[model samples]
Target: MKFGYLSISINFARQIPMLNPTTGEIALFHALLDLKNIDMNFPSTTGKKKTWADGFDPTSATLQLYSGLSANGIVKAREKLKALGFIDFKSRGRRKSTIYKLLDLGSDKSAFNSSDNSVDISSDISGDNSSDNSSDNSVTLIKTKQDKTNTNNTSEKSQATPHEQKKKFSADSVEYRLAMYLFGKIKQNNPQHKDLTESQEQKWADHIRLMIERDNRTPQQIKNMIDWSQADSFWRQNILSTAKLRKQYDTMAPKANSEWQTQQPRKRVYE
Candidate 1:
């Protein structure tokens, strides 16, 4: 069959042996058939890569099909092909290129004939006991399918919760949590230093944000007030220090208190 510019052929048999370009092995016919969807590309003598997109390019397709083989497998496959007189390859020099040519298999056509014989055998077997053979095959297929379904369900159930999953799936999210924890620790240690100037507070916030973004939350051991504020202690001190500083600086500044006191009057006894 031809789809677009790619051609596909299938040869079925009880034990069909052929060279597997992908794995460079002698495998059963069914195994090759299973790789029907793989895309292949080949290089031409003109040193240009060919593809199905440009009409039929079997040479490029064949080379691409063999590209997946391991180095050792490729060597073995080439040797086997040489022995069978099916293909020959030559290399000119260390840095030079190689060339390949296909040879006829002659009268050893039994390899291709096996595919036809297998079809006859299948027909004979099916005709002799059609109902019983079909029932057996159906039961086996059902069991295999059920086993796969159960395994997938078990896997899904073992998955983690969203919060836990997020932490596991993303290193950045985990770092964010650690940064929050470090800020909490910082705030806890600097209860009295809650009145940090605006610039100082902004600097610490920016640092925490950057650490979270970079996913670098390695803990440091410095105990200085500023260091503690940058560590995980910032969270704890945020609320307490904000309230205290507001009371001290906004409500009870000496000048503000004096003004409030002056505005108050003393009661006179004239009645």
Candidate 2:
């Protein structure tokens, strides 16, 4: 991606802390903003012309270079940014880079939705609905125990509910075997790593299930990815969780293919 200057509004910048972004999240957000700018200014040289509407589709390495964050940091920070409504990701495909859409910070839209209600960013930050009445659409940054609890609860419920809904998988199932295989690899990598609870194990199994059923990955492909991710130096540390493995599958696939191909034994014939 080409370099482009960011022009963040002062009002927008002020509300960032209210969203309680981590240092990595903040840096990644700015890096995305830069990408957005680049997309708007530079017309496509070969492919379809990209606009802000089309969104940016930079690779993980590109993001790491721009944001000065590790691969793991980019993933975690991207998830946080989505939770805070700072950004959204649109999947291109299993192999293509995902398109990132930045949300309008000054809008009255809620950062996230709950089962019962939409959690407004302003109310969540200030711990009061009155902040929404302000003529200027800016979130108030106030630190309160209740506010912290509300944010944490919302984040937890959103992430946990999906896994909790997953049906049980038996030991003989491929999902279960893959989950166990991953856990075993993790233990081998770090002896001090804590063992998974029953619920945690089930959750990991569910992620593998999604990989096969939803992502259209074959059992063999998923196994290969698990093996490659676990054995690779950088991915070993970052892909400790099956969830992370699923999230990064597309990005890691090409590299894994190259690695796998190089390891194949070459046949020789006497001439």
Candidate 3:
């Protein structure tokens, strides 16, 4: 993108110490602001607020370039910002760019301090009636016995949930594995395909889950289809994604069965 400038308020900068978990996260946070500012400065015929009310809609490509992080790294940074209540992502739909909201960080500022990194959401957020804020929104709070002197200790102790030992979403988990498997298949078909960010990778996994749960394709069947399609030149490029597979599953399943049946030996002499 063109050279965009960022303007951060003093209060927003102060909040970062308690919120940002990594250097990439800090970059992402600023990148969003820079994008919004760019929108604000650009001369538009439509006299709107420069950006959408929610925030700027940045592509995975834009974020990767802006933050200097890979697809996997960008996803983790976005997650960290969301977990800290600094940002929120709003999905538009399939093949649509996602909208991001720079949340009211001031509202949750008092919850974070030099002594403790934890945010008490139960007390900060509203009643249970408003709990259904989003389809994916969930609230959980964990408090750690913190010492005022050591800031590093507080950062280390900050966990997503009280019982969870590791990050909620990990690269080694099933979700990421599914993503990578499909990603590799796509790359195999189209050797010149561009790299995908974590958001796009997760979308691939979600499509796979849809195939398994909604289309009733077994995991083994999906694996078989992946191998069969990639080995076949005509269908290799056609079967680009799980979403595409879901669309053709009904047709392909029967064809797969027919091919398997034809491959078997014929007992013509016995007949």
Q: What are the TM-scores, per candidate, against the unseen true structure?
A: 0.21, 0.39, 0.34
Against the reference, the lDDT scores of all candidates come to 0.29, 0.58, 0.50
Per-residue C-alpha lDDT of model 2 across residues 182-271, encoded as one tens digit per residue: 776676556457878988888888887766555655554565576578769999999988789877876787676665556542411000
What's the best-to-worst order under lDDT?
2, 3, 1
Q: What residue pairs clash in candidate 3, if any at all?
A: none
Q: Worst ten-residue run, lDDT, model 3?
A: 1-10
Candidate 3 lDDT by residue in tens digits, 113-218: 2123221221122224224322223211111122336665333321123333232334433434444555555553454567677656656666655554444444
Clashing pairs in 2: none
lDDT of 1 by residue, 202-268 (tens): 3333443332222222211111122223322332344233222212222222333243236433421
Candidate 1 ranges with C-alpha deviation above 4 Å: 1-23, 26-65, 107-271
Which candidate should be chosen as best, given TM-score against the real structure? 2
Give the Cα-based TM-score of candidate 3 against the true structure.
Answer: 0.34
Ranking by TM-score: 2, 3, 1
Model 3: how far residue 208 lies from native, Å: 56
